[model samples]
Target: MHQPNKIAFFLFFILLIPFGVQAQGHEVDSLKNELKGHSTMDTIRAGLLIELANKLTYSDPNEAIPLMEEAISISKKTDWTLGEALSHRQMGNLHYVLGDNIKALDEYQKALALSHKITDRQLQSSLLSNIGNIHADLKEYDLALENYHSYLTTSQEMGNRADEIKALSNIAIIYNDTERFEKGVSYLEKALSLSKIEENDLFIAAITNNLALAYKKLDENEKALSLYLEAAELAEQMNNKYIEASALNSIGKIYLLFNDYDLAETNANKALALSKEIDAVEWQSDSWEVLSEVYEHNRKLPEALDAFKKHVQLRDSVVNEEKKSELTRKEMQFKMERQQAVAQEEIKRQQLVKNGYLIGAILLLIFSIMGYLLYKRRRDALEKRKLAEFNAKVAETELKALRSQMNPHFIFNSLNSISDFISKNDIEQADDYLVKFSKLTRSILENSEKKWITLEEDIELMKLYMQIEGLRFDNKLKYHVSMDNSLEPDNVLVPPLILQPFIENSIWHGIAPKKGGGNIDIRIAKDGTMLKYIVEDDGVGRSVQNREEKKTKDSYGIKITSSRIDIINHLKNTKGSIELMDKAEGFRVEIKLPLELQF
Candidate 1:
């Protein structure tokens, strides 16, 4: 076949059938028998018509064409999509046989679209090959190559080596037509290898022929002649006159090129006879051209001139006919496009009106939802503010009650210490003690007025208390207070008197009972987002557990402090509490505060 250009030898392989039939006549007879028993509207009847059309595609394609069209009508009425697709494909095959490639392509595309709707991968693969061949015939190499690759891939995946070899040969022909002789050689080699392994004479013939053409293009005339002889013999064995004619024509040209006038004339006359027998116009023209060259080399001017004239006449006629076909196809396409454009414009105008109403309705719904959301959020915010204010007032009231329980006991103890100093006639020490005690009292009193105080103010109060105790105990009680340098004391907030009771309990119950009065160490640091306070005394632990029971008046400071912490935790949803530990040598109090920053 002339693929990319006229007189350019290339393989234009038709896709092989999926079903295996022994004889076309037998298949057509069987389908006709099946159709005769079924009704006109019967599904079996529709399938029989399409199958019959396929069976007659080579022998009598004109008869097959109407059969395919009838099958399509019946399948459509029955809603048989696969049948419809097969009918279109059958028609395409018939049209392609008649060389009506434009109509063939239209039918192949319809079949392809329908094939995708079903799960028949074989049908889809065949449709792609058919479409590719039509494109190749029309010189649409890019589209041809695209569909050919798809066909080859599907054939490989399906393990259809016959179809694979066929696809490879066709693709190689396209490369040869485009003058990429090396690329053509590569594809043809692969196809030839596969064909030899498969041992299929028809496939081997097709690849060998295309490979020969490729070698001929590269000036490997000896190699080309050998391959052409092999292909001609194989095609003869398979009774494929088309490939046989192509092989002979190529051999004749190679002979003509090498100045073997007698041998070239012999091959060219034989090729022209076979082409005439098969009614292959293109091959006939090729044979005529080869004869013209051979005769001219032999110095037969008259015979050469007559042969050249015949070759020119055939070539020009073929070229002009193809040009006419292409122009007709283009004209039809232009008219169809104009009709489609008018329809699209109408649809676009209608869609514009529809979209306008849809947008208006959508915007109205959006604004309505926004208004409702805004009103709901404002009401929710006001309710949350009221609840927060109520919680604060309740926490404040409960805190005031706790402070009242904690303050008097410490003040009373300090007053007694001051009085003892005066009774001992230590006036200077008494004055110093009195001043520190008053300052401590003022700090406690000021902190008692708030629900929460800055950590800095709280720590200052703790220091004041420690100082006053040191003065009263005559510095017998040593203390260590360590604070984290990273802590922002002025920014962090804690409830008033939260840490005081723990320190006081450690001093009175643990240290005061001991004679030597061991040191009280307070370590304050941040543990992630929580504050940690470690108040330890090495005086005594649970060994003095019973000492609290023997006290004249029970100091309920520890009990009251625990109750206040529990209430604060419940109200604020925080983890703030104290843990008492009594080790072998000392008692320790661990206090954890959920640190809240002033901001």
Candidate 2:
């Protein structure tokens, strides 16, 4: 259950957001009467119109729409540029709240274009965040990030602590959504620290609330609850219903977690009343969900069902299915393009293999003809030539297979995740991600093009791969890398990018689908003249996983790895084999390869 936050950035004092109208302690009907009476003063009328629009934005957006349109037209006719801009900006926020992302973007752009007419850097900065938020909602992350950075940088230049914290908090939201909770927590901590300096109750409540949510995602419920309590108290002191309601709803969930039925029910109902008081549809939905959970666990089946139905009704009414479909189509198209690029790369590799075979045959034929002409002296040359041709073909095919081991989707998603850290101002975390990303990419590029790499390099590359995957899974997927003490990894030689596929299989197939996440163990030990590499996971057994995979196609990586192993066995005069076992609780894979050493 998630309570909603306004997508608009907090307005700075000196330069009020063109769209901002803090109409507090005033009734909507009174504002309408004021709008009706101030016709001659276009500025006053426009202001009243915007105030009504802002108030209705969260409650009854349908009525707010025509009011904002009338305000903009009247303001333009009266040559009130700022009023017109404010109308457009507020209109954008209204659309965002209603889930009309396309119209939201258009209105935000119009606001931004008009922002150039005014010298209010603060309003302009807020517009950047509004633009970024809409882009993020549409899953256009790159554009969203660009605007968020602009928001942060603008506030930093202006030295507004409030705006800076707002930017940080919002950027952390993007991180939380992307499952980069560790980095998200870092960002939230920074924002919370800065906000504490300001001693602004409303700002403090907002940041701590976000921090609580980030901690909750990391499964640190105690920390989450503590922060939520602090946020609730701060929000109450400021008489802010939005923050107070959000905190109460979150607290109710925590209570549910601890099975405190009475406390959960009490807090959820309080939050529900507050949400309804403010006409916060999203928070009202969240309240219903928490209440449903409390009822369900308390064995009040009828109440639970009723609460659930209300929650779904609100959620379904707010979410626009057409926008969801459009976003899905865009995502699908992007994936298809990426897959096509990978396929085209494979085609090139296949053509290279064909060329290698043709070239090898031609070379062998030329050598054989020469050997026949000088049969007495070159008898040994023919045998050497034949072996060279075979080795070359094997190496070429192995190279192609090695190159295929790095999935483009994995690389793109990893890189995309890193950008979230940057936006949140968690530069340290961003740097750490970049380091791991650099190691992974460099290893793939360098080793895939090589015939063999030191076992030490191979193990290091595998560790980096697992570390990156561990981050993707929010560290819920634990992994271990260990080797026998006697095995000198630097002296031992192995096929390049060899262990990655098996480890990847354990991660994606074995650990990832587990409910609470699982662990992977990669260990290497000496077994006679061969090195045994074991990959194991505490997840669904292979038998169960296979059963679940009935409609899914088999992985081609395994086939490629098997073929590469066969080639290595024949060329190196060693036995190599891979075995997959379905363990009682999970899956285990072992790869046995003859130990080859470099002098």
Candidate 3:
């Protein structure tokens, strides 16, 4: 996933400036000789220093830094605005290559300010591109897009097709980073059209590769493959080994995904060789990663392990350097900002001291207003605390009332079931049912006074109730309860007897009315921040039950349960809900409550 954009990022960095470090080394040396012979702090010397620094920006950034600083100083002394702006922009490029994004941004902003002062549209566009690149690396997509748009507009106005292509490609990369591949494709197509018109093979190769990446992300693999091949061919023709290696590595990865291990390995090896030749460590790392997967899929375990180790080593080398550079940039930025803030505070303090009488009166008025606000705030806090406490007490009282109403109603149903068992001349079963009923009653009493009980405790009470009822129907009332593994029964709490009435109603109104009786399934699981309870019975449905008993007492228990849930919703300020559905063979009831945890 990260491979494609990283390849595009490499291309963007290389395309940022026109001059190549190794190709211009002789030119840099000649400029240095000229500067030494001239030995004058004029605009020419400043310009020479800036040019030399630009050449060394990538090859030896540390050496370039002093040269850039000297050029900025000399340019300011000579009133050479263009020289100063170029010096700052070059410094920005050097910092960018070094991965010091904060410093790079600061330098770009300084250059941008100078560009505006001189109305240098070309320089302004370049600075905007540099700033956009920094923001894109930082994942500030909005700011990156804003700068890129400005860069595109400036380049178009200046009739610079090359810069326009670069701007479009950069904007496309940001869209890709944000996972908006369609938008990325739109921009890349525009860039590709412009590149082809200009007959720029380098731009063509890079844009084609980027467009392929967008297609790959969109799952248009066949299109992606064809474009990758074209990009690779173009890169080979131009002798741009970096892009060729990147395209080959991407091709190898796609082949790996397709399970074509032979082709994957072949492409990976080719890419690795090209990357090694170019000293492109990141691309070499990517190639080794593809090879590792290919080897693993082929069951070449030892080779796979070796390839994997090489990939990790190379990747960590690049990643750790980037991390360290980022940390240093942030630390320096924080210190600079802190110093500026402290200096501003000192200046304000001095100003206040200078205006002594005005300061004293203002301070007195400020203190008086603060005192009044504190008094009002304290009063408001007291009122809010008192209201909260009162609401808590009311909620507790209401819960107790609901539980009191539920318990007796629940006991009456159990007692009535026991009476029916005895009336059917089942004396032995009635005794057993009574014994279990007493145990369940004891458990219910233990939990009655509490506002909430652990799910484990509630389930235990439920199982006992079901057992007593199961005995009444000669074990025909079967039930299964299951919970999600992600939930800990002992740690999760529910309102005491909250689910009892629903379970009771399912047994009496749903299963009891069926011919051969039926099964009940209880499922408890987590639903985001809510707890879900589903009670379903494969018995007579609600429609049939309503037809058989038009005025059932179980409806009373359901109404009470609904009222209790409404109170709970009010107390918790949550959207706890209950849903009832009538299946063809049975009835289903789903209840969602605010999940409460003990810890």
Candidate No. with top lDDT:
3
For model 2, state the Cα shift of residue 234 in Å: 2.5
lDDT of 1 by residue, 301-384 (tens): 446556755775576567546645655544444444444555765675566556656678687675575567557655755665
Q: Lowest-scoring 10 consecutive residues by lDDT in candidate 2?
A: 8-17
| TM-score of structure candidate 2 | 0.44
Per-candidate TM equals 0.53, 0.44, 0.58
- Model 1 residue runs over 4 Å out of place are 1-30, 58-66, 95-103, 236-239, 332-350, 356-599
- Model 1 is weakest, by summed lDDT over 10 consecutive residues, at 1-10
Provide the RMSD of all predictions against the true structure, rounded to 1 decimal.
39.9, 19.5, 20.0
**For each candidate, what is the lDDT?**
0.73, 0.75, 0.77
Judging by lDDT, tell me the better candidate of 1 and 3. Answer: 3
Candidate 2 at 511: error in angstroms?
42
Off by over 4 Å in 2: 1-100, 117-120, 273-599
Candidate 2 CA-lDDT value: 0.75
Superposed by TM-score, candidate 1 places the C-alpha of residue 94 at a distance from the truth, in angstroms, of: 3.9
